[model samples]
Target chain A: MTTSPNSYADKAAEVAARATPERLVVRVRALSDRAIAWLFIAPTIVLLLAINIFPLFWAIYLSFTNFRANRPNAEVKHVGLDNYTRVLNDPDIWVSMQTTAHFVFWTILLQTLIGFALAYLIDRKFRGHAFWTTLILIPMMLSPAVVGNFWRFLYEPQIGLFAYAVSFLTGIPTSEIQMLGSVNLAPWAIIIVDTWMWTPYVMLICLAGLRSIPDYIYEAAEVDRASNWRQFWSITVPMALPFIMLAVLFRGIENFKMFDMVNLLTGGGPGSTTEVASITLKRDAFEAWATGRSSAFAIVLFVAVFGLANIYVKALNRVKQR
Target chain B: MADVTLKGMTKSFGKGGAKRAVDGIDLHIADGEFVVLLGPTGAGKTTTLRLIAGIETPDAGTVSIGGRPMAGLAPASRDVAFVFQQYSLYPHLTVYENLAFPLRSPARRMDAATIDARVREVAKMVRIDHKLESRSTRLSGGEMQRVAIGRALVRRPSIYLMDEPLSSLDAKLRGELRLELKRIQKDLGATLLYVTHDQIEAMTMADRIGILAEGRLVQIGTPREIYADPANLHVAARLGQPHINLLPAGLLPGVEMPPGTKTIGARTEHIAIAREEGGNARIDWIEHLGDQNHLHIKLGEQKLVTLADPDMAVAPGDPISLSLKNPLYFGRDGQRLV
Candidate 1:
């Protein structure tokens, strides 16, 4: 038999043609991974836009309009910078802002400090550590509304257990003291309730951080001639700082937007003295039907939280990079 | 520097003390001597090192450094530095900061300028001076190990304890670092106690090697003495590459002795193999190593390996003669008979 040169070339070209399509298909399959990844991420992006971005832009728009909820048919006339100026100059708004700052600063401070201390104590793995941790976490797990209502009863003047116990312990009269009614005591009451509710959350985060450290580190530090206090400062604190900062960021944001506990416990109480921004915004929009002004207030609160949270996220990223 | 001594040292774990992790180990290292504790896993080498480092208090023994009792003195007070196998450099700190940590430690109490100078000096000694500004996470395995050593060395502690510091590196790096470690220990004249299961490391780097087995000190000697005259069959087996071959041998009634072949112990390289030609038996297999070939020859009922030249051609199932040259005879209980 004789083989033609042209026929062999034709066969080789036919083989190449056959392999090219399959190779192209493989190439297309490999390229589709990026598309699949984008497809998986798209839903989260859409949800974030719907929940956070859309409401933010809408609030900003409403803040510049005179669209009061009581007058629905009234024209949404543009009032450039007027509501912002009013909110900035308003004495009541400033008071609520001060109250918010006070709550956020004190609550975060106390929560972080107490939570870290408790975490360090529990990390020692003594007897009944798990039991004690679970007990501490009960306050964090309780519904804020229920806790507020329960605390209100406990703070009752004569009949409540807390008041009676305090009076019994200190030998002071419990008949006239009103925890949620007095302006001086109401902020402290809110701060106390907030710290009680969130300290356990911080403790849990710090505990995870502490437990993630290997025992060899302490052994090495011991071998390095590091004292107990030195190890705690250099090794333990630096290692747990990221988790502690995370707790602070979470508690700070939550306290800044704190409404449920304040609403349930004091209802922004006695003569606007305990009215936080959230309570004031609620009164403006729902009680007085001033949606435009409330939207402006809401926008301001959103900016404050967003800016602070962004800074905190940057700090967290820095820690993780380290 | 302190001469560390452990007398009747025993440590046990578990609630009822039923489990003995380290059982009755007695060891002493002279000041500025580099000693290596060699053992397999679960052999209590690390426990022994930790005991000497004061990380763990012995239940039965008293540990002393420089003739002072170390019963209640904390690890820091004992003036010992430990380098862990994991290289426990602070991940958040730079190489310089990690090296400076031990120097600035309150227990050490060096001033700021002194700490900086010592850190830089140790960093240079470890050949990681350029990496001083670099974060530890960015460092390679060898670099990290060097930094760990630098951290331990910066304080000039009385005793240096290293727990498998080179175990994580590759074979070539381990060999290179072993030499470096020996040179550094010799140059600094620091009392070093190193722990590793790698016999080669113990053999090459240790001034005096201590062999441990099952939480017990099996043997301790210089590398030459340990290799030449092992106290037991286990030490004989553990000290060699392919391990010393154990074969039952009976003394022939009036065999003439060969002069200058009276070394105690079976050296595999001394055994010879040739075609049987009406002699011992046959070759079972041939394992061709790169430089030399090992001929597994069956003599009577026992098989013994004989080193052959790489150029020598030998195949399996071939008839072969075996001759044991200067074989150390052991009795039924695995003890060498004179």
Candidate 2:
């Protein structure tokens, strides 16, 4: 049968009319959504480029030049890795590196152990858990400089409470003892003070991680008839590993470039025994006016920290994915 | 398998009687029997399970496994396996390791070969053998749940305590796992104390169901007994689908029904409806379900829902005859009149 032309044309028109408005609206909506998304993201991108990327490139460029702050108007000489060679070969630089490693390792280990214990104790949810947590967090909230000064006073041999307490407890003669004046005791002193100040920070993070775990897990562990030690090892520790690593990373980076606490407490004293890399870098750039060498040293320190932090972040991501 | 008995189990939160989470509860679960605890939220089903698992100690009770008092005994000393609702598999461990954990636990003290064999066997039973190497966090919800079941199964404890293990899964998965759980329980022949708020799960899975409200066991019976003869209005309302029709008998005028049947409850399918104008009722609406239709009828200010065949033609305002079959009657105090 042959169809009428007008009827066929009318059917085609009907189909076209039904499809046009919805399609146009959808296209307009999609374009507007894209525009709105870009509008929201533009400021963040610009700020990141200005504050983070540009400065990183500037620092990289500055590392290769013999640029001294005192001789600002002088021509910036291209040193061609001379500063890096000097930093890598210097015995004092190696000493500082060793000191930094010692400080980071001891402080992070002590802080993690102490912090996890405190978090576990407080996670039991007693009558005054909130109050205790707030009290524990006070040291972390205080300025590092203030804590350094306070601990410096406390470490004084004659008038310090710690010295008197130690002498009373151990019957060690305190008359000739000087805590911050000795090479052997100074690094440990700095580590102790740093632990006292920052262990609570680690504890708070650990507490959050611990509390985030559902009680059902512990219940399941119990049902499986896991002993207390087993529960602590398998359930509590593994679940809180990410937080522990996070605490390690924070304390590691902080101790690597530790300046304020060391400067106030020991001033890198006892013949540079307590002088870490950051302190050495500071003395070179500001005190000794070896700005080029110090910049190179700072760059080395930056690369080490960046590499370590990248590895830690990858571990943290893997833990989170699990 | 061993029988579990809770004698005057009472657990309180905070000192000086701040809150009592579980009040004095006395229950006996026989060996190789499946008992389902039904309760509303905060009714202490989970607390009771924890107490039985030795995760929490009762303030004033003796929990016994096989007639031996578990007082002061650690959880490890009490031979009971617990399955949690959230599928508490170690996220860092693989499905194999997760199942092998309890098997290798020092308290359980299975040898390496035995642990390996048990893990393999339970994994096969749960049908998660293929995904044994996969990290538990990567598994789908159903797979993770199966792995959790396998983990519990590997222990071969005397008693099995599950706290709403299938609550988090979707409906289809829940139905499938319910059957699996029942089959596994039967095969293991373990004394299983399961807790769930879903009445259907309790009905389908339990040899006997214990209903709890406000930390007290209100009623305990088999599935047929719970459905056919509910102890109270709460049990009646909570235990049925197309929910049991509740109609006030006093409102029906000139109807000489049973004098003790003040409030009548009947399953929707049990109520009969017809187009004959014998009763004083009018159809309000008709919901055409695929296999059957639900006829919503109004009778003297009460709504009566009736299930009929889909082909039955009924419209709003159509006169209909109504009669309740095997209706349950409740007294004025809300207790069943049975």
Candidate 3:
């Protein structure tokens, strides 16, 4: 074959002969562009309706009735807003909501500040910056369950590196640093772990914002006689604010529904001190079998998150407009 | 106001400083003078401006502003205003804030009322007062450029350095802004150094023009002198609109060349054309440009374009006798022969 003089020509002719331009009866209808687009998206819409929309409406319907998953054959009574009222008045549920709020607030605040600082330092483009960035991103790359379990050992009083370091810093005994056991320190412990794991995600977004700013703008600022401090406050902060806010929004939503990490770490605490709303929801739906009340609680949480996110997105848009 | 002086200024980049972005060049910009550095891309014009503005440090020379050596001085301390080629206005700031930025600096410590008044004044000067409240990012290219210029103008800096500030605009906007800039500079009587590749901008605006080529200042003089008495072929080719015609020596009659004249630089003003039956040149084509006609001529395998009147009695293939009148002459080294 290698010695054949017209091998390429023969192959070309053979392939050309095989490629018969055949005409067959076409069955596809001439759909308008709008129809074609809808056709292409129909399956995704149907799947979303079946799995997401149907479940959502079903949860809403179930919230209105006193239905118990354990007693499936029992007659479900229509409870007119009774579950909502109960959820609103329940002190334990209130405490869980407060805990969720605290976690969201502290984690977002700490993550934003630390993440923005880290992004600023990385934007300096120093030597070993690539290695440092990769190292910083390791926490975000790990599974939340792994991160939670990993931090659980670190929060241990006797052998934990974190407890030992804190004890050494403050001259306190390592045995007294009951991070997971103490009511006061358990929330802080979870916050620390979450901030450690998710701060890199925020930093990545902020780094994008910082890098989007052209070098000429800084040069122009310098020529305008702005000091480095002034430039950071005026140019750097304002330009990167939208990205920072986006990171906050993401972490705020994710941490609100946080179950796996907290469940893995302390299982809602040494006495429900770290009992976020999701853990309460899980206990109500599965352990207590109060499906109606839990559904109401889930709907309330959904509405609160959706409303807050909508307001936050509007504010983010305002910042971006600036 | 300050006079800028550069002595043996040199800058280079890359390892071991192999690529010289700016070579050794000496220049002096008198106080209240407008100097335009005209060059093609990568000719070190912007680098020269950056070096003077202290955005870049010289590698082997000194830059002194107001007779004070600017060594180790930061750009913010140099008292120079630079308008970048792209409008580098703060996207988060409005037109008014952009204008007020320099005044709000802690170093300036301008009062709020005074800053507001100055911002408005500069905005009005640049004809952007109507859009003062609009975000800088929301502006069109022309409006943004106006805001950028206004931002530079708000401060009473010692020198203004602009790097192709009008190049980003369309032709009409560039023309309007060019006139406005000249007027504003005249009103302020401030020292300004402008760099552009557009010949018309340099020729029309500069009190003195400096031709830069390959990181060297090839020639520096009044625009008229630079256009009429270029030091070399490069400087001669830098200023003309239709471009100066470089022809082999003795291509045309009626001009006395100095000894060793290897090239003749014939612009529209230097060339004399007359219609004839058996002429030495033939009109290849006449490009109609509304106001004036560009006559492309062919003479013995050589082609040259010269500007002619729109109603000139000539068409393609018309034979014409061409002569040179005190045209510029250059030697084999491309250096002008007086």
Candidate 4:
């Protein structure tokens, strides 16, 4: 019953011992809202810096130098803007740029047209629509590497199904029409495979857009004495324009950096006929071991994609506003 | 403008649950008449409107416009225009484009100048001409509805079908547009088959109102006729603001009613109320609504309402005498007895 410091200290020691360190910490302390949030997100921030931001800054720094990864003992000279100028002035890089532009334009056009047509057909709620929709989406689900390998085999001149079918239809020999070997046909082959794989992706987005249009709008159109074609152009297209544009933007960004399918099918062979920008960057960085030059090429590509996407996004916003 | 006739039209939707949305109902709306289909929610008024517009095919019966059967005809071929309840304005188009959409359709290819001229005329008719260049989302609800009406009117089809066009507006806006719509219908002299759940709209706009209950048209008459005499207890109960007082004829021991009558109906305005000491009812409350007063009165374990003139002074707990004028009588089946 005596109130003494010794007794009080003993009581405090007893209480502290009864609550173990884990229990004490859990029950006695509370972090502030911001501290808790930061604690939860710290790992993500650290990982993002290590994997994404650090490499970006590193590449920007490396683009200004003449450092080759293969030649370690060579002096890392600070050649200001030399890599940028060299990459820009090189005619080979322009060829790749042209290839990329051609690929992006054709692939987008084919995918959008075919994709929107498929979407319109599926929107009819025809017999077995759900089953057909799932089946049509199979192409988009296959891995690009697998698709490329199979398509390359199909393009084989002698024993391939595609060449034989063409030969059978046109009365030409299968050996004479080589899809992968010929320079002119190699580009078409890659474009065809890309359109085949990605058209379903575009169609999926368009299907969602088409489905989202309310039934009442069409009914109103009907009551207004509009023909079916008129309704299609006036109501359906305008309503689904935003979603279609969104799909285009996504496909454009993806196809601009396209590498795997073309690489697997042609390996940028047939005398550099189908070498896209990403393919050239890959060859320079990993094969030639010219890290600084490859980094500059990659920067140019990144800026191009970023700028084009920004422009497309502005158009998308305007469509949505309308 | 043309007459719209529906002969025993019926539509039943059985997808999730079997419900007859519109039973066999016959109606003949004459040329240049504004007829409103009045009912509660889910009473198949909209379905009937859709059937008349050829948007829905009747399971049994046929709709004829201008003496021609609408069987196997598309909505476009039926020569009708429809306005929806939600003001389904095309959100992506300007008001001018929305008004011009119907006119510029390939079927109705009036050249650009004529289309533009008609758009201007209808826009002015709806009083939305000034806001024609604005995007639909930027306009207010009333303006959107006006544009919707303008869209329906641009082509001047043979008949007009409107589905609860004023239900989305606020009360004040609905009143203003209701008046505007009445004026437009008169000026155009166009046949319109309008549908609404609001009785005030039915009373104010329709030259004749048709009452629907459980997918059947029970009665059709002028507004004054429907007001003075509803077809049955259901129509009587649905048509008034405070609601018609429906009483069992045999329950009121002192009130005199026709023999063999099972139900009695009286609107608030038709009921006679007087302040008396020896009274049969006690006032529970008085609600002042500007120029009108609503009296909540208790009568023999039943609560009834009576509308009082604003000048009438009364309060809760006051004794009052209640009488019925032109009391409605119904047999046990709820059909009106003349």
In order, candidate lDDTs are 0.84, 0.87, 0.92, 0.90
- Please identify which of the two predictions, 2 or 3, would achieve the higher TM-score against the true structure: 3
Model 2 agreement with the true structure over A1-322: per-residue lDDT tens digits: 7899999999997797677898786666676877889889999989999998887777677778888888889899898899999999999999999999999999999999999999999999999999999999999999988998888788889898888889999899786457898777888999999999999999998998899888878877777767789888888898998988888888888888899999898888889999999889889999987778887888899999999899889989988788
lDDT of 1 by residue, B137-165 (tens): 99999999999988888877778999999
Model 2 / residue A271 / CA error / Å: 1.9
Clashes of each: 0, 0, 0, 1
For every candidate in turn, the CA RMSD to the true structure comes to 5.4, 5.4, 7.6, 6.7
Interface RMSD of 4: 1.1
> In candidate 1 chain B, where is summed lDDT lowest over 10 consecutive residues?
B255-264
Q: Pick the candidate with the highest DockQ.
A: 3
Summarize candidate 4's per-residue lDDT along B162-223 as a digit string, tens digits. Answer: 99998999999999999999999999999999999999999999999999998999999999
Rank candidates by lDDT, best first. 3, 4, 2, 1
Which digits, one per residue and each the tens of the lDDT, describe model 4 over residues A219-322?
A: 99888777788889888999999989999999999999999999999998799999999999999999999999999999889898999899889988988987
- The prediction achieving the highest TM-score against the true structure is 3
- Each candidate's TM vs. the true structure? 0.88, 0.88, 0.93, 0.92
Instruction: Please identify model 3 stretches exceeding 4 Å from their true place.
Output: A1-32, B250-256
TM-score of predicted model 1? 0.88
Comparing to the true complex, what docking class would candidate 3 get?
medium
Error of 3 at B63 (Å): 1.3
Per-chain TM-score of chain A in candidate 3 equals: 0.89
